[model samples]
Target: MIKYALKCEVDHGFEAWFSSSDGFDEQAAKGLVECPMCGSAKVTKAIMAPMVRTSKEEAAPIEMRQAVAEALHKIRKHVEDTHTYVGGAFASEARDMHQGLTPERPIYGEATTEEVKALVEEGVPVAPLPVMADKPAPAVQKKLN
Candidate 1:
């Protein structure tokens, strides 16, 4: 199976799946393919953009690279927009906030295995994110080991 980015003559863009390239050609030749929105048969393949790589190394295909990059970008943006970092004082701060001793806010921080267990046992809502907590501070330059 294959998917093609299709565009109608009216400039509407959409996706279409076919068994093969020949299937797409057959459908187009018979006017079986039409724009879902405008019902126009004047459709053609849309140009796909190549993916951007982070390193000089040759990697997976462009589409897979683009998908992974997009997913990472979305997660990073979500963390930036929705969460606050509490640094190393995560467990105690979380407890304080949960117990009403401190103001509650969306926070991410470092906590030991035992500390996390305690928080869960006490019913203080917490979840781990896919991102690493030891990210370098803005002022510090990171050296890849």
Candidate 2:
């Protein structure tokens, strides 16, 4: 199946599907297609770029994935090196900081789901770490090693 962007003489734009390229020409010649909004039969195909699909390997090249992994690793490293690791005291520490009970400082730590929900409800800003895997990717590990 093929889809084409069509425009009428009155400049009304719409789309229609055809079985094949020849089918579109045949239907258009017989005035089977008409502008949906203006009801004009003088419709023609508008300039369009064809959509192409590449194989999975080509779609996400190794270099692209490696660059993304490297970026995430840098972010995780920065957070770990710069932010205080409060461990299980995440909820209390975050709450204290928000309520001005403690000095404001960047922190990264573990929090229970209940603790997280409560923090959000109380308008304390907190978010989960984005590190997906406990172990770094083989590429990153190799670079470190």
Candidate 3:
């Protein structure tokens, strides 16, 4: 089945599905097709936006993938070199820092969903990292022989 964005002479736009391009022409020729909004038979195909393909490698070049990997690696390394690992004490550590009970430092760790919610509710300014805070760089899997 094929879908086409259609526009009528009255400037109304809608979508219609047909078996094929020929099927649409055959239906339109016999006055079987009409605009849903205006009931006008003077409908024609509108310029449709191109569909995006989502399959991984089909969407980007190898070079682009390599570049992205490099960028992510750099970011992970920077985070590792700079931040203190608070482990499972993330919520408490963040709270202590926020209340000036501890000196301010960049820290990463695990927190339960409820703890994260509490942090946000208290305006503790926490953000979840894209990579797992514990694993970081090695989160990118290496293919084994």
By summed lDDT, the worst window of 10 consecutive residues in model 1 runs over 136-145
lDDT of 3 by residue, 85-138 (tens): 889999999999998999999998877656766786788988765342343234
Instruction: Write model 2 residue lDDT over 1-145, tens digit each, in one string.
Output: 6789989776878887678888889988997776655345688999988978766434446677677667777777889999999999989999999999999999989775567768877999876554446677888767645
Better of 1 and 2 by lDDT: 2
Clashing pairs in model 1?
A: none
Index of the highest-TM-score prediction: 2
Off by over 4 Å in 2: 1-57, 132-135, 142-145
Can you give the TM-score per candidate against the true fold?
Answer: 0.42, 0.55, 0.49
lDDT of 1 by residue, 25-122 (tens): 99999977776554567789999774465788564565664454455455655776798988789889999999999889888877755676688779
Provide the overall lDDT of each model, using Cα atoms, as 2-decimal numbers.
0.70, 0.77, 0.72
Q: Which candidate comes out best when scored by lDDT?
A: 2
Error of 1 at 17 (Å): 28
Best-to-worst ranking by lDDT: 2, 3, 1
Error of 1 at 33 (Å): 48
